[model samples]
Target chain A: DVKVTQSSRYLVKRTGEKVFLECVQDMDHENMFWYRQDPGLGLRLIYFSYDVKMKEKGDIPEGYSVSREKKERFSLILESASTNQTSMYLCASSLSWGDLEQYFGPGTRLTVT
Target chain B: EDKVVQSPLSLVVHEGDTVTLNCSYEVTNFRSLLWYKQEKKAPTFLFMLTSSGIEKKSGRLSSILDKKELFSILNITATQTGDSAIYLCAVESAGAQKLVFGQGTRLTINP
Candidate 1:
Protein backbone atom coordinates (compact mmCIF):
# COMPACT_ATOMS: atom_id res chain seq x y z
CA ASP A 1 0.00 0.00 0.00
CA VAL A 2 1.06 3.56 -0.63
CA LYS A 3 1.49 5.56 2.55
CA VAL A 4 1.45 9.35 2.46
CA THR A 5 2.37 11.13 5.70
CA GLN A 6 1.81 14.75 6.56
CA SER A 7 4.06 16.55 9.01
CA SER A 8 1.31 17.90 11.23
CA ARG A 9 -2.18 16.66 11.90
CA TYR A 10 -3.28 19.98 13.38
CA LEU A 11 -1.81 23.47 13.47
CA VAL A 12 -2.71 26.97 14.67
CA LYS A 13 -1.11 30.18 13.53
CA ARG A 14 -1.67 33.90 13.75
CA THR A 15 -2.44 36.18 10.83
CA GLY A 16 0.46 37.11 8.53
CA GLU A 17 2.48 34.19 9.85
CA LYS A 18 4.20 31.92 7.41
CA VAL A 19 3.27 28.27 7.61
CA PHE A 20 4.85 25.14 6.24
CA LEU A 21 3.14 21.83 5.65
CA GLU A 22 5.20 18.81 4.68
CA CYS A 23 4.16 15.59 2.99
CA VAL A 24 6.18 12.43 2.42
CA GLN A 25 5.27 9.36 0.46
CA ASP A 26 6.83 5.97 0.94
CA MET A 27 6.10 4.65 -2.54
CA ASP A 28 8.37 7.16 -4.26
CA HIS A 29 5.59 8.34 -6.54
CA GLU A 30 6.54 10.89 -9.19
CA ASN A 31 3.45 13.05 -8.77
CA MET A 32 2.44 14.99 -5.69
CA PHE A 33 -0.54 17.32 -5.12
CA TRP A 34 -1.68 19.78 -2.48
CA TYR A 35 -5.31 20.70 -2.01
CA ARG A 36 -7.52 22.50 0.44
CA GLN A 37 -10.79 20.87 1.41
CA ASP A 38 -13.47 23.31 2.41
CA PRO A 39 -17.06 22.92 3.42
CA GLY A 40 -19.37 22.45 0.43
CA LEU A 41 -16.46 22.99 -1.96
CA GLY A 42 -14.84 19.59 -1.70
CA LEU A 43 -11.16 19.48 -2.56
CA ARG A 44 -9.67 22.22 -4.74
CA LEU A 45 -6.19 21.74 -6.08
CA ILE A 46 -3.63 24.27 -4.88
CA TYR A 47 -0.42 23.06 -6.42
CA PHE A 48 1.10 19.94 -7.91
CA SER A 49 4.53 18.66 -8.74
CA TYR A 50 5.20 16.16 -11.46
CA ASP A 51 8.90 15.83 -10.60
CA VAL A 52 11.51 17.14 -8.25
CA LYS A 53 11.95 20.93 -8.46
CA MET A 54 9.00 21.22 -10.82
CA LYS A 55 5.72 22.73 -9.67
CA GLU A 56 2.53 23.94 -11.31
CA LYS A 57 -0.29 26.06 -9.99
CA GLY A 58 -3.71 24.57 -9.70
CA ASP A 59 -7.14 26.20 -9.52
CA ILE A 60 -6.55 27.88 -6.19
CA PRO A 61 -2.90 28.89 -5.79
CA GLU A 62 -3.07 32.42 -4.42
CA GLY A 63 -1.05 32.95 -1.22
CA TYR A 64 0.31 29.40 -1.52
CA SER A 65 3.41 27.84 -3.05
CA VAL A 66 5.00 24.42 -3.16
CA SER A 67 8.44 22.78 -3.21
CA ARG A 68 9.65 19.38 -4.27
CA GLU A 69 13.26 19.14 -3.30
CA LYS A 70 13.22 15.33 -3.31
CA LYS A 71 11.19 12.64 -5.02
CA GLU A 72 9.54 11.43 -1.83
CA ARG A 73 8.86 14.79 -0.24
CA PHE A 74 6.57 17.71 -1.17
CA SER A 75 5.97 20.83 0.83
CA LEU A 76 3.21 23.48 0.84
CA ILE A 77 4.04 26.95 2.02
CA LEU A 78 1.70 29.76 2.95
CA GLU A 79 3.39 33.08 2.49
CA SER A 80 1.00 34.93 4.78
CA ALA A 81 -1.64 33.05 6.62
CA SER A 82 -5.03 34.61 7.29
CA THR A 83 -8.23 33.64 9.02
CA ASN A 84 -9.71 32.68 5.69
CA GLN A 85 -6.90 30.18 5.21
CA THR A 86 -8.20 27.99 8.01
CA SER A 87 -9.19 24.73 6.44
CA MET A 88 -8.26 21.09 6.01
CA TYR A 89 -5.26 20.58 3.75
CA LEU A 90 -4.70 17.31 1.97
CA CYS A 91 -1.63 15.83 0.26
CA ALA A 92 -1.78 13.17 -2.39
CA SER A 93 0.72 11.19 -4.47
CA SER A 94 0.39 9.11 -7.61
CA LEU A 95 2.72 6.93 -9.67
CA SER A 96 2.56 9.20 -12.69
CA TRP A 97 0.76 12.22 -14.12
CA GLY A 98 -2.01 10.19 -15.73
CA ASP A 99 -2.44 7.73 -12.87
CA LEU A 100 -5.98 8.31 -11.70
CA GLU A 101 -5.61 6.64 -8.35
CA GLN A 102 -4.18 9.20 -5.97
CA TYR A 103 -3.28 8.04 -2.48
CA PHE A 104 -4.00 10.75 0.07
CA GLY A 105 -2.39 11.55 3.39
CA PRO A 106 -4.27 11.87 6.66
CA GLY A 107 -4.56 15.65 6.08
CA THR A 108 -3.59 18.67 8.15
CA ARG A 109 -6.24 20.79 9.83
CA LEU A 110 -4.97 24.32 9.87
CA THR A 111 -6.43 27.13 11.94
CA VAL A 112 -5.39 30.70 11.33
CA THR A 113 -6.47 33.24 13.87
CA GLU B 1 -14.59 25.13 -18.14
CA ASP B 2 -14.53 21.50 -16.99
CA LYS B 3 -17.22 20.93 -14.39
CA VAL B 4 -18.45 18.00 -12.32
CA VAL B 5 -21.81 18.07 -10.57
CA GLN B 6 -23.32 15.70 -8.01
CA SER B 7 -26.97 15.57 -7.20
CA PRO B 8 -28.85 15.31 -3.88
CA LEU B 9 -26.26 17.27 -1.95
CA SER B 10 -27.18 15.25 1.14
CA LEU B 11 -29.24 12.22 2.09
CA VAL B 12 -30.16 10.29 5.23
CA VAL B 13 -31.31 6.69 5.33
CA HIS B 14 -31.62 3.84 7.77
CA GLU B 15 -29.32 0.87 7.79
CA GLY B 16 -30.05 -1.90 5.26
CA ASP B 17 -31.61 0.57 2.87
CA THR B 18 -30.33 1.03 -0.66
CA VAL B 19 -29.21 4.34 -2.09
CA THR B 20 -28.08 5.67 -5.44
CA LEU B 21 -25.77 8.66 -5.80
CA ASN B 22 -25.53 10.60 -9.03
CA CYS B 23 -22.61 12.38 -10.68
CA SER B 24 -22.56 14.30 -13.93
CA TYR B 25 -19.70 15.95 -15.71
CA GLU B 26 -18.93 18.22 -18.65
CA VAL B 27 -15.31 17.98 -19.51
CA THR B 28 -13.22 17.98 -22.66
CA ASN B 29 -10.92 15.12 -23.56
CA PHE B 30 -12.42 12.85 -20.91
CA ARG B 31 -10.14 10.24 -19.47
CA SER B 32 -11.79 8.65 -16.41
CA LEU B 33 -14.32 9.14 -13.63
CA LEU B 34 -13.39 8.35 -10.03
CA TRP B 35 -15.38 7.92 -6.83
CA TYR B 36 -14.04 8.65 -3.38
CA LYS B 37 -15.39 8.25 0.14
CA GLN B 38 -14.42 10.91 2.61
CA GLU B 39 -15.03 10.90 6.34
CA LYS B 40 -13.61 13.71 8.46
CA LYS B 41 -10.19 13.51 6.87
CA ALA B 42 -8.75 13.02 3.44
CA PRO B 43 -10.79 11.27 0.81
CA THR B 44 -10.23 7.54 0.17
CA PHE B 45 -10.30 5.91 -3.24
CA LEU B 46 -13.38 3.90 -4.04
CA PHE B 47 -13.73 3.26 -7.76
CA MET B 48 -12.50 4.46 -11.14
CA LEU B 49 -14.47 4.05 -14.34
CA THR B 50 -12.85 4.74 -17.69
CA SER B 51 -15.25 2.87 -19.90
CA SER B 52 -18.97 3.17 -20.12
CA GLY B 53 -21.55 0.37 -19.69
CA ILE B 54 -19.23 -1.52 -17.29
CA GLU B 55 -19.91 -1.75 -13.60
CA LYS B 56 -17.33 -1.86 -10.82
CA LYS B 57 -18.25 -3.43 -7.53
CA SER B 58 -16.76 -3.85 -4.09
CA GLY B 59 -18.73 -5.51 -1.36
CA ARG B 60 -21.96 -3.49 -1.03
CA LEU B 61 -20.92 -0.61 -3.26
CA SER B 62 -21.04 -0.59 -7.03
CA SER B 63 -20.67 2.11 -9.70
CA ILE B 64 -21.44 2.44 -13.39
CA LEU B 65 -20.64 5.17 -15.89
CA ASP B 66 -22.30 6.37 -19.10
CA LYS B 67 -20.20 8.07 -21.70
CA LYS B 68 -23.16 8.99 -23.86
CA GLU B 69 -24.94 10.76 -21.00
CA LEU B 70 -21.73 12.03 -19.42
CA PHE B 71 -22.83 10.85 -16.00
CA SER B 72 -22.28 8.12 -13.43
CA ILE B 73 -24.19 6.41 -10.67
CA LEU B 74 -22.96 4.85 -7.44
CA ASN B 75 -25.21 2.33 -5.74
CA ILE B 76 -24.79 1.11 -2.19
CA THR B 77 -26.81 -1.92 -1.19
CA ALA B 78 -27.61 -2.90 2.40
CA THR B 79 -26.12 0.29 3.68
CA GLN B 80 -24.36 0.29 7.04
CA THR B 81 -23.53 3.03 9.49
CA GLY B 82 -19.93 2.84 8.35
CA ASP B 83 -21.15 3.90 4.93
CA SER B 84 -22.05 7.32 6.23
CA ALA B 85 -19.63 9.64 4.54
CA ILE B 86 -19.24 12.13 1.71
CA TYR B 87 -19.19 10.50 -1.71
CA LEU B 88 -17.11 12.52 -4.15
CA CYS B 89 -17.00 12.27 -7.93
CA ALA B 90 -14.02 13.47 -9.91
CA VAL B 91 -13.33 13.58 -13.62
CA GLU B 92 -9.94 13.38 -15.27
CA SER B 93 -9.49 15.00 -18.64
CA ALA B 94 -6.81 14.18 -21.13
CA GLY B 95 -3.95 16.71 -21.34
CA ALA B 96 -5.05 18.11 -17.99
CA GLN B 97 -2.86 16.97 -15.14
CA LYS B 98 -5.56 17.37 -12.48
CA LEU B 99 -8.97 16.01 -11.72
CA VAL B 100 -12.10 18.14 -11.49
CA PHE B 101 -14.08 17.22 -8.39
CA GLY B 102 -17.74 17.57 -7.61
CA GLN B 103 -19.08 19.17 -4.46
CA GLY B 104 -19.95 15.64 -3.15
CA THR B 105 -22.98 13.90 -1.73
CA ARG B 106 -23.16 13.65 2.03
CA LEU B 107 -24.71 10.28 2.97
CA THR B 108 -25.81 9.46 6.47
CA ILE B 109 -26.94 5.99 7.49
CA ASN B 110 -28.82 5.61 10.72
CA PRO B 111 -28.97 2.37 12.60
Candidate 2:
Protein backbone atom coordinates (compact mmCIF):
# COMPACT_ATOMS: atom_id res chain seq x y z
CA ASP A 1 0.00 0.00 0.00
CA VAL A 2 1.15 3.54 -0.70
CA LYS A 3 1.77 5.64 2.38
CA VAL A 4 2.10 9.39 2.78
CA THR A 5 3.55 10.39 6.13
CA GLN A 6 3.44 13.76 7.80
CA SER A 7 6.09 14.68 10.33
CA SER A 8 3.81 15.72 13.15
CA ARG A 9 0.26 14.74 14.04
CA TYR A 10 -0.29 17.60 16.48
CA LEU A 11 1.62 20.83 16.99
CA VAL A 12 1.27 24.03 18.96
CA LYS A 13 3.21 27.20 18.22
CA ARG A 14 3.25 30.82 19.20
CA THR A 15 1.47 33.30 17.00
CA GLY A 16 4.59 34.85 15.51
CA GLU A 17 6.77 31.78 15.43
CA LYS A 18 8.01 30.19 12.27
CA VAL A 19 6.61 26.71 11.64
CA PHE A 20 7.37 23.85 9.33
CA LEU A 21 5.18 20.93 8.27
CA GLU A 22 6.81 17.98 6.51
CA CYS A 23 5.47 15.22 4.30
CA VAL A 24 7.06 12.22 2.65
CA GLN A 25 5.56 9.71 0.26
CA ASP A 26 6.81 6.19 -0.13
CA MET A 27 5.68 6.00 -3.74
CA ASP A 28 7.64 7.81 -6.41
CA HIS A 29 4.79 10.13 -7.25
CA GLU A 30 5.90 13.10 -9.32
CA ASN A 31 3.19 15.41 -8.03
CA MET A 32 2.76 16.60 -4.41
CA PHE A 33 0.26 18.97 -2.86
CA TRP A 34 -0.40 20.88 0.39
CA TYR A 35 -3.84 21.97 1.52
CA ARG A 36 -5.44 23.52 4.58
CA GLN A 37 -8.86 22.32 5.66
CA ASP A 38 -11.32 24.34 7.69
CA PRO A 39 -14.79 23.59 8.97
CA GLY A 40 -16.99 25.58 6.61
CA LEU A 41 -14.54 26.51 3.83
CA GLY A 42 -13.53 22.92 3.09
CA LEU A 43 -10.13 22.04 1.75
CA ARG A 44 -8.20 24.89 0.08
CA LEU A 45 -5.08 24.26 -1.91
CA ILE A 46 -2.01 26.03 -0.60
CA TYR A 47 0.82 24.87 -2.83
CA PHE A 48 1.90 21.98 -5.05
CA SER A 49 4.92 20.63 -6.93
CA TYR A 50 5.01 18.55 -10.10
CA ASP A 51 8.73 17.95 -10.19
CA VAL A 52 11.70 18.16 -7.91
CA LYS A 53 12.42 21.80 -7.01
CA MET A 54 9.46 23.02 -9.06
CA LYS A 55 6.72 24.55 -6.95
CA GLU A 56 3.52 26.37 -7.84
CA LYS A 57 1.24 28.56 -5.76
CA GLY A 58 -2.34 27.52 -5.25
CA ASP A 59 -5.41 29.59 -4.33
CA ILE A 60 -4.48 30.14 -0.66
CA PRO A 61 -0.72 30.44 -0.99
CA GLU A 62 -0.57 33.99 0.28
CA GLY A 63 0.98 33.21 3.66
CA TYR A 64 2.60 29.87 2.81
CA SER A 65 5.54 28.52 0.83
CA VAL A 66 6.72 25.06 -0.14
CA SER A 67 9.96 23.20 -0.85
CA ARG A 68 10.48 19.96 -2.74
CA GLU A 69 14.17 19.31 -2.39
CA LYS A 70 13.74 15.57 -2.88
CA LYS A 71 11.40 13.53 -5.02
CA GLU A 72 9.82 11.72 -2.09
CA ARG A 73 9.73 14.60 0.37
CA PHE A 74 7.75 17.85 0.35
CA SER A 75 7.69 20.53 3.02
CA LEU A 76 5.31 23.35 3.85
CA ILE A 77 6.75 26.41 5.61
CA LEU A 78 4.86 29.05 7.43
CA GLU A 79 7.04 32.18 7.52
CA SER A 80 5.15 33.49 10.50
CA ALA A 81 2.32 31.65 12.13
CA SER A 82 -0.85 33.48 12.99
CA THR A 83 -4.02 32.67 14.87
CA ASN A 84 -5.97 32.45 11.66
CA GLN A 85 -3.41 30.07 10.23
CA THR A 86 -4.30 27.38 12.72
CA SER A 87 -5.97 24.54 10.89
CA MET A 88 -5.60 20.94 9.79
CA TYR A 89 -2.92 20.64 7.11
CA LEU A 90 -2.98 17.80 4.63
CA CYS A 91 -0.36 16.45 2.23
CA ALA A 92 -1.10 14.55 -0.96
CA SER A 93 0.68 13.06 -3.94
CA SER A 94 -0.19 11.64 -7.35
CA LEU A 95 1.63 9.72 -10.06
CA SER A 96 0.96 12.07 -12.98
CA TRP A 97 -0.37 15.43 -13.98
CA GLY A 98 -3.92 14.54 -15.07
CA ASP A 99 -4.38 11.80 -12.50
CA LEU A 100 -6.84 13.36 -10.08
CA GLU A 101 -6.93 10.68 -7.41
CA GLN A 102 -4.28 11.68 -4.85
CA TYR A 103 -2.97 9.67 -1.91
CA PHE A 104 -3.13 11.78 1.23
CA GLY A 105 -1.22 11.82 4.50
CA PRO A 106 -2.86 11.53 7.89
CA GLY A 107 -2.74 15.34 8.27
CA THR A 108 -1.11 17.65 10.84
CA ARG A 109 -3.27 19.66 13.17
CA LEU A 110 -1.50 22.95 13.93
CA THR A 111 -2.69 25.17 16.71
CA VAL A 112 -1.45 28.74 16.81
CA THR A 113 -1.59 30.22 20.26
CA GLU B 1 -13.86 31.25 -9.24
CA ASP B 2 -14.00 27.46 -9.42
CA LYS B 3 -16.16 26.01 -6.65
CA VAL B 4 -17.59 22.77 -5.26
CA VAL B 5 -20.64 22.52 -3.06
CA GLN B 6 -22.17 19.64 -1.07
CA SER B 7 -25.75 19.44 0.03
CA PRO B 8 -27.29 18.50 3.39
CA LEU B 9 -24.34 19.54 5.53
CA SER B 10 -25.29 16.78 7.97
CA LEU B 11 -27.40 13.64 7.99
CA VAL B 12 -28.64 11.15 10.57
CA VAL B 13 -29.79 7.65 9.73
CA HIS B 14 -30.33 4.23 11.26
CA GLU B 15 -28.26 1.11 10.67
CA GLY B 16 -30.59 -0.39 8.10
CA ASP B 17 -31.43 2.88 6.32
CA THR B 18 -30.03 4.03 3.00
CA VAL B 19 -28.59 7.48 2.42
CA THR B 20 -27.59 9.60 -0.53
CA LEU B 21 -25.13 12.50 -0.54
CA ASN B 22 -24.95 15.18 -3.23
CA CYS B 23 -22.07 17.19 -4.68
CA SER B 24 -22.02 19.98 -7.28
CA TYR B 25 -19.16 21.76 -8.94
CA GLU B 26 -18.49 24.81 -11.09
CA VAL B 27 -15.04 24.68 -12.50
CA THR B 28 -13.08 25.57 -15.62
CA ASN B 29 -12.11 22.71 -17.91
CA PHE B 30 -13.51 20.01 -15.68
CA ARG B 31 -11.31 16.93 -15.68
CA SER B 32 -12.94 14.62 -13.16
CA LEU B 33 -14.85 14.27 -9.90
CA LEU B 34 -13.81 12.28 -6.83
CA TRP B 35 -15.42 11.11 -3.60
CA TYR B 36 -13.65 10.55 -0.29
CA LYS B 37 -14.61 9.30 3.16
CA GLN B 38 -12.91 11.13 6.01
CA GLU B 39 -13.04 9.60 9.44
CA LYS B 40 -11.07 10.79 12.47
CA LYS B 41 -7.83 10.66 10.52
CA ALA B 42 -7.31 11.28 6.79
CA PRO B 43 -9.83 10.99 4.05
CA THR B 44 -9.82 7.74 2.11
CA PHE B 45 -10.46 7.55 -1.63
CA LEU B 46 -13.80 6.08 -2.59
CA PHE B 47 -14.54 6.76 -6.24
CA MET B 48 -13.45 8.80 -9.24
CA LEU B 49 -15.78 9.57 -12.11
CA THR B 50 -14.57 10.99 -15.40
CA SER B 51 -17.45 10.00 -17.64
CA SER B 52 -21.11 10.66 -17.09
CA GLY B 53 -23.95 8.11 -16.85
CA ILE B 54 -21.74 5.31 -15.54
CA GLU B 55 -22.04 4.24 -11.94
CA LYS B 56 -19.27 2.95 -9.74
CA LYS B 57 -20.01 0.66 -6.82
CA SER B 58 -18.08 -0.94 -4.00
CA GLY B 59 -20.04 -3.18 -1.63
CA ARG B 60 -22.60 -0.95 0.03
CA LEU B 61 -21.40 2.32 -1.52
CA SER B 62 -22.10 3.54 -5.06
CA SER B 63 -21.50 6.78 -6.95
CA ILE B 64 -22.40 8.33 -10.29
CA LEU B 65 -21.42 11.53 -12.00
CA ASP B 66 -23.36 13.78 -14.36
CA LYS B 67 -21.05 16.00 -16.38
CA LYS B 68 -23.79 18.02 -18.04
CA GLU B 69 -25.26 18.98 -14.68
CA LEU B 70 -21.83 19.29 -13.02
CA PHE B 71 -22.91 17.15 -10.08
CA SER B 72 -22.47 13.74 -8.52
CA ILE B 73 -24.26 11.56 -5.98
CA LEU B 74 -23.02 8.98 -3.51
CA ASN B 75 -25.41 6.38 -2.16
CA ILE B 76 -24.81 4.15 0.80
CA THR B 77 -27.05 1.20 1.54
CA ALA B 78 -27.32 -0.69 4.83
CA THR B 79 -25.83 2.10 6.82
CA GLN B 80 -23.59 1.15 9.71
CA THR B 81 -22.05 3.14 12.52
CA GLY B 82 -18.64 2.35 11.11
CA ASP B 83 -19.69 4.06 7.88
CA SER B 84 -20.16 7.34 9.71
CA ALA B 85 -17.74 9.92 8.41
CA ILE B 86 -17.45 13.16 6.53
CA TYR B 87 -18.05 12.55 2.83
CA LEU B 88 -16.11 14.98 0.66
CA CYS B 89 -16.47 15.79 -3.03
CA ALA B 90 -13.69 17.27 -5.07
CA VAL B 91 -13.12 18.30 -8.66
CA GLU B 92 -9.97 18.38 -10.75
CA SER B 93 -9.78 21.02 -13.42
CA ALA B 94 -7.51 21.47 -16.46
CA GLY B 95 -5.84 24.68 -15.34
CA ALA B 96 -4.12 23.27 -12.24
CA GLN B 97 -3.26 19.84 -10.91
CA LYS B 98 -5.08 20.50 -7.66
CA LEU B 99 -8.41 19.26 -6.38
CA VAL B 100 -11.03 21.73 -5.14
CA PHE B 101 -13.17 20.19 -2.41
CA GLY B 102 -16.62 20.88 -1.08
CA GLN B 103 -17.39 21.58 2.57
CA GLY B 104 -18.43 17.92 2.97
CA THR B 105 -21.44 16.15 4.39
CA ARG B 106 -21.09 14.84 7.93
CA LEU B 107 -23.00 11.55 8.21
CA THR B 108 -23.90 9.95 11.49
CA ILE B 109 -25.44 6.52 11.71
CA ASN B 110 -27.19 5.43 14.88
CA PRO B 111 -27.18 1.88 16.09
What does chain B score (TM) in every candidate? 0.99, 0.98
TM-score, chain A only, candidate 1, equals: 0.98
- Docking quality class, candidate 2: high
Model 2: per-residue lDDT, tens digit, B1-111?
Answer: 999999889999999899999999999999889999999988899999999999999999999999999899999999999999999999988867889999999999999
Model 2 RMSD vs true structure: 0.8
**True-vs-predicted CA distance for residue A45, candidate 2, Å:** 0.4
Tens digits of lDDT, candidate 1, B1-111:
999999889999999999999999999999999999998777899999999999999999999999999999999999999999999999999989788899999999999
The list of candidate 2 runs beyond 4 A from truth reads none
Against the true two-chain complex, what DockQ does each candidate achieve? Answer: 0.78, 0.85
- Alpha-carbon runs more than 4 Å astray in model 1: none
TM-score of each: 0.98, 0.98
Instruction: Compose the digit string of candidate 1's lDDT tens values, residues A36-78.
Output: 9887887899999999999999999999999999999999999
User: In candidate 2 chain B, what residue range of length 10 has the lowest lDDT sum?
Assistant: B91-100
Which 10-residue span in candidate 2 chain A carries the lowest summed lDDT? A94-103
Best by DockQ: 2
Candidate 2 TM-score to native: 0.98
lDDT of 1: 0.95
